[model samples]
Target: MRQNHHDGTKRWARWEGASLPTNVRPPILADGRHSSGLAGCKGGGHGDPKAAFAKAPTFSPDTDFRARVAAEKFHLCRTTREKGRMGPSKSSNTAPSTLQVHRTSDLRRLLADRPTWGRLACGVPFRDPRWLAPWWDSFSESAEAYALVASDERCVIRGVLPLYRRSNHGYRDLNFVGDGAACSDYVSIACRPQDSTAVAQAMAAYLMDVRDDPDHGWDGVEIDGIAESDETMRSFAQALLVGGAAVHAHSRQSTWLSARRATWEDHLRSMAKTTRRKVRRFGEQIDGAGGLTKRVAETENQVDAFLDELIDLHQRRWRAEGVAGSYHDSRMVTFIHSVAQAFFLSQRLYLPTLWKGDRMVSAELHMIGDDRRLYCYSSGYDIDSSHLQPGRVLLSDTLRELYRRDWTGIDFLRGDEIYKRRMAATPQRIVCLRVFSPSAAGRIRFETWSAGFNAKQWLRRRLGIPPLSVVGMCETGTPSR
Candidate 1:
C-alpha cells in the first residue's frame, strides 16, 4: 500500500509497494534486487511490439488497476482547480496543484497530445517511445526512470521533468537519461511559457526534500544541457539557494540557427561573406556535375542501409585524423540503430545522402520535431572527398531543403566544431548543473567534482592534452559540446 507523509514539503508520498500498475514497463530485478526508493519507476512505460532494435521484449503490466489510479489523479488535479488554487491566466507562486510521477513509458501518451505539450516539448528524439524505449531499456540495469508531471488545478499537465537515477563513480547521480550516450538537447522543465519558472521552482523544492530524506541518500542531482537563456535553470538555482542548498553550474554549447528567413537566398546571405561564397561555389560545383543525386530513406531498410554508410564514412573520416569516432563504441552503435528504426516507424526520421552514381559521398541523420523544427544529430562524409567539401555541401543541401519545406529552424545539436559555427547563426550556451543538499557526503562529492572540473579546464585543454571526456571514453559526464 502507498503511504502518505503528510508534511508541508508537498511532494507525492510513497509509490505503492506492489509492482507498478500499467503503461510502465517495470524492470525485472536481476538477482531479485528491487529498489525501495520512491524516486524511481513504480513503473511508467509505452508499448513496443517491434524487437528489431530492442534487446529484450517489452514488459506488459496490468492495465485495469493502473487506469483507475490515473483517473483518480486527474480527479485530484481537477478538484484543486475548482477550489481556486489555480487560475487560467496566472497561478499562485505556490507549488503546482498536483504532482504525479510517471515512468519513461508514459512519455508516449503524454507527448502524443502535442497541441498542449508541443510548445515546450522535449526534443523529438527524446519524446518518441519507439526511440526512447529501446535506448532506455539498454541501460535498464543501471538506470531508474522517473518523470515528474506537474498539473494545473484543472488537471492539465503544465510541466513534465523526466530524469533518471543511477550510480556513477560510486555516487548516486540523478540526471538526464540519454546524456551519456546520444547528447540529448533542449531538455527543459516543460510547461506553458508563462508557467515555466513556477514549475521549475516547484520541482526544485521537491527534489531537495527527496534528497534530504535520510532514506533517499542521494549524493547529487546533475542537470545538463540547459540553454543559458533558459529561465527554468535560473528558477531552479534560485529555489535551491532559498532552501540553503548549493548549486554548481557549468557551461557547454550547441550550434543554433534561425531558419525562419524569408527565403533560402536570404538565409545564405545572412552568413559570413566567406561562408556564403564557399557554400555557393561548392553547391554550383556539385550541381554542375549533373550526376549528383540526393536520397531520403523512405523505408526501414533504407534507414538501416544509410545508417551503415554513415557509420562507415564517419569512422573513416575520424580514423584519417588518427582518432576513433563516436560510432566506434558498440553501445552507441546499438543505441543509434534502435533510435533510427523507431523514428522511421513514426516517419520522423530523415536520412538524406548525397550520391554520385552508385557512390555515396555525404549523409546526415535528422529528426523533425512535433513543432516542425529539424535537429541534425549526426552526419558523415567520405574523407577522400574533402577537396569537394562534402560536409559543407551536404549541410547546404539540408538547409535549402528545409527552406523549401518552409521550416523555420534547425538545431545542429551538441558540438563546437568549426563547421557548426560557419553555418550556425550563433551558439547557445548550455550548462551542466549540479545541486546538492546540506549533507556532508553531498558536499564532499560536489567539492571533489568541482576540483576535478577546474583541473580539466585549467590543465587538460590548456596543456594540449586530450582527456578521456573529449575522446568519448564513456566519461560522457556532462553537457558535451
Candidate 2:
C-alpha cells in the first residue's frame, strides 16, 4: 500500500496486512527507485511512447476515484492574486458552487467548440503519460491538480482551466503550472481563437470565484512565466488585478530568440560590439581549425543520439563542479526527448551540435515557440576549447540559421551569464508573488522574517546586496525595461 502526504492531507492505500484492494491498480513508478521523502510510482515508467503523439491520446486515470480526486484538488487550488491578502470579498461564497472534472469526451467536445485548442491539446514530443496521470488522482481528491469546464445555461463547454494547488510559506497558494517557471513556455489556456477575449474573461471569473471560496485554501496565486505577447493572458492578469487582486509586482521571467531581421549580420549589429567580436572570432577559429561542422537532428533515430549527446554534455559540465544538471535523470531525459520530438515535428526543436568529425564536441537543445527560438539548454567544451570556443561557434551558427529562418530573437532564458550580457541582451526579471490571510495557521511563523520585520532585506536589494531568503519571492528587484 502506498501512502502520500500533501498540504496536511494524508493518503494511504487500503491493505489488510497481506491482502490488497482488488480494484487498486498498481502505481506506475518511474523507476524501481523512489526518493526518500517524495511519493513515487510503483515501478519506473516503461519505454518511450513517441508513436503515441500522433493520435493525441486522451489520458485517463486508473480509476474513477483518481479522476474525482484530481478534480477536487484543482478546485481547492488558488489563482495568482495580488501580493497581499485582504478581508474575504462579500461575494466570496457566491462563486461557482460545484466543481466538475471534464472527462476525455468532454475535453474533445470543448476542443471542438474551440479549434485553437488543437494547438495545445495536441500532444508534444516532450509530453509523457506519467506526467499527466497524477491529475486523475489529484482531480478525484481535493488536492494538487484539477480541471474545470466553463459552461452556459445550455451546459455548453465554453472553456477550461487546469490548475494546481501549492502552499508556500504560511499560506496556501494556487497557480497554473502552465504559467509557472517549471514550464519552458507559458501554459496555454485554450479557447477557440475567435473567442480569445471571451475565454479570458470566463477564466478570470472562474478563478475569482474559486478565490472567494472559503475552502479554496490558498492565500493567492503566483503565475511567473506568462509570455509577453499573449493578449488573453494579459487580459486575464489585468482582470484579476482590477478585480481587487493588486499588481504588487511583475517581471519578465523568460526571454526568447526569434528570427526577425533580413540577415544574421543585421542581427549581430543589434548586439553589443564585444559579443559580435567574440562570435566572429569563435567562428573563424572553428572554420579554420578542422573539419568542424554544425548539424541539426531531423529524424526520429537521430534525435536519440542527439539527446544522448546533450545529456552527456550536460553531465560532463556539471559533474566536475559536483552538480547535476536538470536532465541528469533518466525520466527527465525521457521527458525532454518526448518534448523535443514534438517540437521538432512542429519545426520547434533546435539542436545545434558541433561535430569534430564523427563525434559531437558541443550541443544545445532549444525550443521553437510561437515566433521565438527558446535557448532552453546547452552543454559544450568550455575549458580546453577556451581558445576554440566551440560553444560560441555553435551558438553563433545557430543564431545565423535562426536569422535566415526569420526568427524573432534568441531567448537566453533566466540566466545571468556574462555571455548573455555581452550579447547585448537586456535583463528580464521574473517575479513570484505570495499572499496569506491575516491569521491562517502557521502564518506568524512564515512571516517571522518578512520585509515588514526585516527592513534590511529590502535595503539589500536596493544596495545591490543579495537578499537572505532561499525562496526567490522574498527578494525585491526592479522590473526590466
Candidate 3:
C-alpha cells in the first residue's frame, strides 16, 4: 500500500514541523477524457497587478473557538478586507503581518479541535451536514481531491478549503480547483470572520511546504472559480506570490439583472428594443399555448419525475437531430440522478419546468444560492412550435418569476447561445491554467500536443458536439449541456 501519511508518529512529527522530501515525478501522458485536450483552458486571463489584496482568513475564539487555538499555537489573528481591493489601508493602520502555511494532513487535527469548518457563504447553507457527506465522498473517491482544514483546540469549527487534484487527459497535466466542476460556484475558504489571515497563512504555508517537500506531490495550487469579490481568493493570491509561486489574475463574467425594480415593465424596459421585442413575443406565444404553467418541486421525491421528463425531452431533441444524448448511457443518467437528488435534499436544487396543460415541453435546472440564481442545466422543445417556443418561453417566464423571488442575477453558467444574447445577459470567461513542475515535464509536453488534438474536434459540430463545448477527438458521448 502507498505509505499512509496519517500514521500517529509521522503525524506527530509533521505537527512539530517535520519535512518529508518528495521528488517531483515526471508528468505522465495519460490517455483519457482529461488529456484529450477538447476542453480549452479558457476563462479569465491575467488581470491588473496593482489591485489591493484581500486579507487572508484567520481563526476566532469568542464565537470562533478555532481562532483561540491558532492564537495560542500559531500567534494567528483574524483579519478582513474586501475582495480584489489591494494595498494596505491608506488610513495609516500598520501593514498586515505575513501569513503562513500548514499541511493537508495537519488540517484535520485543527478541525478536530474546532467546532466546525468555515461557514457556507452562499444562500444554500454550504456547511450543513447534508453537504458534508457527499462533499467528503467526492473528495475521497474522485481521482482528484485535495483538502485543507484549519481549526483551533477550542472548537471543531474553523475554516476549510475543499479542493480537487485535477489532471487534463490531453496534457496529462495536474491542477487543483473546488470539488464540483459544473455544479458549484463562489468557492473560497470557509472560516470565522477573525480567522481570515490565519486561514490564508495556513493555505500559503501548506502549498509552499508541499512544493518544497519532495514527498508531497504538487506543482502548485491554482484556486479556480473564486468569485472576484472573495477575500480568500485575494489573500491566497498574495500568499502564493510571497512564497515564490507564480500568480495570474483572470476575469470571469456572470450575467445578472437587478430584481429590485418597481415593475416588470421597468425590468423589461432596461433591455434593448430588439431583445425586449423577442422576450415579449415569446411570452405572448406561451400564453396562447393552452395557458403555460410553471411549477417548483418542493421536495426531493418530486425531482425524479421532473428529471425524467427533462431527460425525455432532451433525448428527443438530440435523437431528432440524429445525435446522441446523455440518457443513452446509464452512467451519465445515474450521475445526473444522483447529483440532482443530493442537490434537492440539500435544498440546493432549483429546477423549474413549464408545461402546457398536461404536456411538459421545457425545463431549466438551477441552483438557488449565494443570493444568485445559477442556471445549471436547461432543455426545451425542438419541434418549432410557434405558439409554445418552449425554450424561449420557459426562460422568459422564469426570469419574471426570479424577479419576484428577489434574486440579483442569473449565472447562465458557461457557453454561448442566441438565447443568452436575447436575455441581455453578457458572457463571462472561465479560464483554466496548467502549472507543471520540473518532474512533470513529460506531462507538460503531452498537454501541448493534446491541446492541438482537441482543437480539431470543432469539425464535428455538424455531428454532435455540445453547444459551444471545447471538442476533442478522444471525447465519445455527447455532453449534456
What is each predicted model's overall lDDT from 0 to 1? 0.57, 0.44, 0.46
Model 2 weakest lDDT span, ten residues long: 1-10
* Alpha-carbon RMSD, each predicted model: 14.9, 15.9, 14.6
Q: Which stretches of model 1 miss by more than 4 angstroms?
A: 1-124, 127-131, 152-156, 455-481
Roughly what TM-score does model 2 have, to 2 decimal places?
0.60
**In order, how many clashes per candidate?**
5, 46, 56
Residue 378 in model 1: lDDT? 81
Ranking by TM-score: 1, 3, 2
Question: How do the candidates rank by lDDT, highest first?
Answer: 1, 3, 2
Please report how far candidate 2 places residue 41 from its true position, in Å: 44
Cα lDDT for residue 105, candidate 1: 31
lDDT of candidate 2 over 1-481, digit per residue (tens):
0000021222223221221111111111112122222132122222211121112212222223223223322321222121221111123232221111121212222223323233443231111122233223223233355344333222334445555566565456666533321243344454433333344444544454445444443466555544444544544444344343432223433443333466667767877787788787666655566667777788877877887886777667666767665555455565556656656766667777787777777788776555354555445553444555677788777666665676666666654566665665665443433333223442453354243524655576689976532221211111111
After superposition of all CA atoms, the RMSD between model 2 and the true structure is 15.9
Regions of model 3 farther than 4 Å from truth: 1-118, 124-144, 152-158, 166-183, 191-198, 212-215, 220-224, 228-231, 247-262, 284-291, 318-332, 346-348, 370-376, 382-387, 436-481
Find the candidate with the highest TM-score and give its number. Answer: 1
Q: Where does candidate 1 clash, by residue pair?
A: 23-45, 24-44, 24-45, 45-105, 46-105
